[model samples]
Target chain A: MKNKVIGNTDIVSGILDEQNEFTSVYSKGQAWLNELRIAGKNAFSEQGVPKFKDEEWKYTHIAKALGEHYHLPHTYSLPANQDLSNYKLLDANTVTLVYINGIPVPELSDKLISEGVTAAPASDVENSSEFKTFLGSVADISNHNFSACNTAFLNNPCIINVKAGVQSPKTIQIIHLLGTDDNDSMCFPRTLIHTEKGAYVEVVESYYSLPNSNQNFCAAVTEIIEEENSHVDYYKYEDVSDSTILTTNTYFKLQRDSRSESFTFSLNGKLIRNDLDIKLTAENGHAELHGIYLPNGQQHFDNHTLVDHISPHCYSNELYKGVMGGSAHAVFNGKVYVRRDAQKTNAYQSNNNILLSDEAQIDTKPQLEIYADDVKCSHGATTGQLDDDALFYLRARGIGENEARNLLVTAFSGEALNEIPNETLRDVFADKIHRKLSVMSH
Target chain B: MLNIKDLRAGIEGKEILKGLNLSVGEGEVHAIMGPNGSGKSTLANVLAGRDDYEVLGGSVLFEGNDLIEMSPEDRARAGIFLAFQYPVEIPGVSNANFLKTAVNEIRKSQGLEPLDSKDFLILMKEKLALVEMDKQMTSRAVNEGFSGGEKKRNEIFQMAMLQPKLAVLDETDSGLDIDALKIVANGVNALRDGKRSFVVITHYQRLLDYIVPDFVHVLYNGQIVKSGTKELALELEEKGYDWIKNEVAV
Candidate 1:
């Protein structure tokens, strides 16, 4: 069968069986993790997978894509000759952390030596108490089915910590490569980032799939917490093969006077859904969410974001742009919330899209829920085709039609791409986008 | 040289240019003077191969190539340029980047090597002087927030940079003041090299005073009704277009 379904109850039943098998193999010296895993499993069982009837998942039907039998494992061996230098960001000082099939291989990681900074796989610190305090604290697994499922099947979670008053000079690059060897496999990759007071850091997370690999499904969750007075810039770039399905959820928590900026660049993928939620829990916090997704062919990309202002005097801004071509489809749902006690909150959200073909489409919704009387909030969304006048303007200047389209698209995505804090990483993303556009034109 | 014979074109099934005829020789500047709705802009847009206008009948020949059969970019590559009546605004695309891409594409089509960054910047700088354009404008998004005069100057700046064989200026001086008009006229005049032709379209004789066209044509109701020397522009200016309409009606 192309898409084998196990029904809702059967899926949760399978998870319970996998949890028992995992407990027998991985619960050695990690009873606390097993307890957390049990809690996550119970949550997933209670809330099964989201179907088309769900309000938040109305546009995207995830059940069909997840209908195939999937294998959940802690680790898998990668090809010895896996070359990743092709994906490295040029001219950026990066401490590369490479993961093969949800497990981190220390041999493939760069030896990091910065003061008050800790970067390693979660499996290495199974005995640390900090893991229990930070793992399920940030991400809301109770309400999110994908997050709960990911937490229940956590393998080798990549955890990054920056101590108070410390600033990392190099960006920590996390590269996850999925290789299934034709098994129609599945993996869950977990990550947690905790920055103490007055700390600063930049992280780049990228996901890729090996060529000729089996059809795979990845359920990943990354939780990030910024303590008081901390600053963080997080960038996620997704460039996977056409045969894989990726559902990733990231949560960010900002304390008083802290800042958080995150940008997601979805270049190419098949059935990708990204969920990003940020919570400003203290006063004087700042958060910026920016993303650009350029999809072609039958690729489907969905981005859902929530910015919750839980405290007073917080600021948040979001901008997302999409360029859909061929028969591709995209969905963007952005929601901003200003709590009743969050007075003087400022939140702004905008999502813009350009559809290149008659069949290509996008659905964008920007929402604002404000309860505080003293707060200022605004949201807007626009979907349109490329401006015909602008296209002719470029073509009349001796530029070919295809090149003109590429230029306009590259420029369309530039608004969000240029906001990347690091110039080197920004150029890296820009270059990838340019390459993608050229390929699309051909 | 450019030639248009019995060119009939329109948009939305409504004929705009019924049966127009015009010709421009090498090293000559031809000014197309007409009143509002006289198909002046239509003629210019048709020459640039704009797809919106359906050429019902007639042919446009430029340097032995059928301009009617070519795409807009091909017409441009074949040294045909149309300075728009209203330049379009493109956000996020820098003027410099747009110009560079246009220049390189044209050069590549002609089997010429694309200019390197340093050489391209030097060429842009030289052309900026021709239009008195601020160097900073090149780094800004293309006409994103440019004033009317600035947009007009930018068109001429691009014309100067591209240096097309036949440049069609469509109402290039409509909203400009005296000072801005002078700069625009000077910019166009500086590019008038031997063998380069221009078809300047305007409703008034104000712009022709600076460039001083060799031949003047008055277009009325989709066709050229009168053709003469530069003095004809002053005559139309003194007598207004009512006389031309009356003459054409007869």
Candidate 2:
């Protein structure tokens, strides 16, 4: 039997038709911004929504998941006295910027009090030259359809700036909440972080749908530019409702001697896609990308990462792991490229997965392209079920079957979770993993 | 405390234990010596509830309960332990954490509160001394990168922690030096408090010299063809199992 496939035109036209109306309400009277939006819209229209025909989207049928119609979020308002305590992470040393439906809610967020740091909504700094110079420079909208779509409908984009030789006192957290009031709604959240030379900062972006929310779509794009000798840690935490479809594109451009580490944790969602791209443009630059995804119960999660070594003496490493159950499907595609000039480049990539049910599926690919003869590059991928010997070993020691499975899964995920630097965040992610695994075991 | 009558078991479709009978009372150590391919390890595994072994026809009674009807964890909670011949290596799980979870799970099954961290650590220290294990060893991954001797010692250390009523040693002395063997035997002897019973399955009589058993049984072609006191072990050591094959031929 042939499946009823949703055409790419139907998905693209639905969003393209809203461009004129969206610009009328959200435009800030900036000519450059309008040009950028128009460029983004044109790029999106030319490419359309990726379909099975697209080589990169061969395994993911995203267009079929998108219905014929979706309401674009125009107004933002939270319920009166809505308690947001459950969505907060790291209370003491964190500067939170809360967003409800892509609109910043300053009253619900913590102010940025650290010296030499500027964290605010884009509207507050629209006229600044730094915002214009670094906004669309890092992310490649011409190639990424989701990034282009997000840029076209961007609303109140968050901006964070760190000056030269300054170390931020606290971690910056961006929290986006999709409320339950709007069904079939979509929101585009954007963030730009630019760090000057010798700067050190940590940023975390988390996506969550309000409790009981359903059928919401979130497209988020974040661009980070690290100057020479800068150090940055970026984390993306996604735990939305089971009916939410999330697509995120994060780009990092590192200069000489700059180092960056990124962690993506995808715990719950209907269909999620994460695209992480890192470009080491100068010598002595390093990048580390790590991710852990646990998708169960018909959920779909895909992670695609690319590390480009453009200069000599650069290093890149990537490790991604997934635990799938209940007919869920997960995909991992990681690529490392070393140019001819990158003589001393060192790149390593690995992807591992465990399927808890017979119906569960995983597709993993690790690719490396090295032109430099002196470079050290290695890539490997593995997919299998939990070791029966390990399970029986635990059960033989009196651990219940459910608990035994939990321990082994926890151990499997701990390899990625241990990469988090903050202790509190590590514990929080550990708890989330434990809770999700317990639910899947049943 | 334990009884197996007419036990017939095998793996994958081939019968190993044709019909075996054995009974052990409390505080008794019974050593079973056999030639290669004998059913000594099969009996030990079947007793510990290893699912791979198919018990074609058998009845295992531990304090009047049908041992075969219970799950491995249930059997463990019901006071049964098996010191594996080749202990499985599990990475990313600390030895101490594994023991803590096992002890607490057993306690939970017996309607007892879980031990707190301080008390658990103290208990761990006490058990570590029984096998002469270093404190740092417990902090490492469970048996990962451990030597043969250390792995064997770890099994005995876990047995001490769980304190099961019936312990099945499956070739525990297969790969151990004399010094490590003596330490392991000493650890086992310390637990002999006239209550717990042990079934030691081995290929050689060297291990029995340290932890002297009260009864010696010869397992040949899946049956206990010979049974006697500790002298039987010495006789097998001196005359070899060929003598037993000759006797059974008659």
Candidate 3:
């Protein structure tokens, strides 16, 4: 892989070199990628990441997905009749960018220069040191070939930058509408949102695909930076009609006294995996992550998240809840790391899942890597069906069996759903999950 | 009207109710007094269509319909209400919301229009007054954070809200204080009507003093071996159950 360094810092040149693999994190990441390459698994290449037939990939295997061998078409018939109004984020009056089949949709995009917020392609920001140095630098993509493959291919990455001292609140929504030409061509989209000192901004990235294509790969990476006294709200929504393979990676870093909150809603995807990383670099930094994933009809969803605390007096909290049925499977792997000097760190993580079917399965692991003896760090994971006692009580009161189950599930996932503070948005996301449950009920 | 003939039921392999028979017409109140493990709760559960109990042989008719064959929800829709002895606690589900769901479900089953939120709240407030239930209990999760007396009062409160045709009070007096018992008994008394009947199951004769059962049946072991008027409850309270168990060993 040939990489160029346009900035004086040469961060990408240094990061892309094989010599950086000496670092432990980079080493493991590289080793993982090496194994993936050996296993002949590249997202687009003929030798893809090893199939789920292997034990490590058994829970979620792309090999079993239909049309896994389709070649990426240079151009897809960009469907023009598709609508984008429903993809708007709450309070997204500032600026928005809608991309369909890698092309921007004009009518629904928010390119308001009057608001002093500028949006452009990755190349526009590539000239700035802040963009190139920090873009793909922190992510140890050495062996996450899927990530590496994405970085190697995604040429039209979007850039959203919020400069220092800006306030009053601004938001941008990135909508990706899958077209029939990309019909079978996997798309690797990337985004970088930089919130400088005292700047407050929000980015809502939503994925909406057509009903015909279940044979596409959506491997994306989104990076965020919150400087001192800044606040960043990042939201991601995936509702792909249960026939897509989507893997999203999020990397975020918080400066001293900064705040970062992320909310994710997964309504429909045949196979979905989300990798989230939040690192606190200074004291008094706060990070919060909330997610809701509802999978039905033999769909598979996986979420891998890590929160790293390097400075003392930082706090990070996470809550992920899922509703699965119809032989649906959900796997969650959450890891929290506390450095030796990161004392007084308050970190907690909980992953709860409900099995709506006897065949529905869930595997959750909450990993804690704590080096600080004086810190309060705890993690918990539970997978169970709705309470039978509650079910009977509801039924005994005349609530039909199906309605009773839905109510219990809504209650179970209500904790995660509460993170959506906006009432209308919360209801919309919850309703989407409810609709998915109704489909599975049949 | 309700009737049970040669009823035998139990959980798992152990028989709880054996050869129990009784009948009650509309507007009548019957009391079943028994020692623990003598199948008192089992009878109430069977009547309410709880699946834990297996009715080996029995015939139960409610309003001339086969009550034994109906599902628990169907039985509830058919106007049978049981005040659970140890009411289960379901956290994260508010009492008011639960009751609303129940009320609407029963309404749907009976072909009656569901109560609007305003009317439902008004009805709940009215029922709360009868049981003297505090608002905190209804605002919190079902049976969660409730005291023993509050739980019993909640049972009566639900009975008030549902307005069932036949209500079975299962150990409603077991954990209540003098005041809670009075409030519970008074709530039941207020709901009594010419069209609805009640079956009160308890171990003590105190509750019977409040409701004043028209017929008293002494259940020893699995069978209702003795029957009498209200005087029978007074005699059981005096002699205790050991004497009857020994006397009725045959």
Candidate 1 C-alpha lDDT tens digits along A1-442: 0112223665567666776787678777455667677778777777777877777787888777667466664446666776779667644578999887677878878878887888888666535557789888887777788787887876567889998999988789988887577655777888889999999999888889876677788888899999999999999889988888888899999999999999998988788899999999999999999999988988899999999999999999899999888888899999998999999999999999988889997988888998899988889999988899999999999999998998889899999887788888788888898888876621
My TM-score estimates for the predictions, one after another, are: 0.97, 0.97, 0.89
lDDT of each residue in B1-250, candidate 3, tens digit only: 8999999899998987788899998988889998988989899889977777798998999989999899889998999999989887887778999999899999988788999999998999889999888777788988987889888888889989999999999989996888878988999999998778999999999998788888899887888988889999999999999878988975
**Candidate 3 ranges with C-alpha deviation above 4 Å:** A1-58, A63-70, A73-81, A86-96, A120-130, A168-170, A179-183
RMSD, every candidate, angstroms: 2.7, 2.5, 6.9
Instruction: Score each candidate by Cα lDDT.
Output: 0.87, 0.88, 0.76
> Which residue runs of candidate 2 sit more than 4 Å off their true CA positions?
A1-7, A29-31
Cα TM-score of candidate 2: 0.97
The candidate that wins on lDDT is 2
Per lDDT, what order, best first? 2, 1, 3
Output the TM-score of candidate 1.
0.97
Ranking, TM-score, top scorer first:
2, 1, 3
Badly placed stretches (over 4 Å) of model 1 are A1-7, A73-75, A90-92
- Rank candidates, DockQ, best first: 1, 2, 3
Q: Pick the candidate with the highest DockQ.
A: 1
Q: What C-alpha lDDT, on a 0 to 100 scale, does residue B15 get in candidate 1?
A: 96
Supply candidate 2's per-residue lDDT for A249: 96
Task: Go through the candidates in order and give each one's DockQ.
Answer: 0.90, 0.80, 0.62
Error of 3 at A370 (Å): 0.8
What would the C-alpha RMSD of candidate 2 be, to one decimal place?
A: 2.5
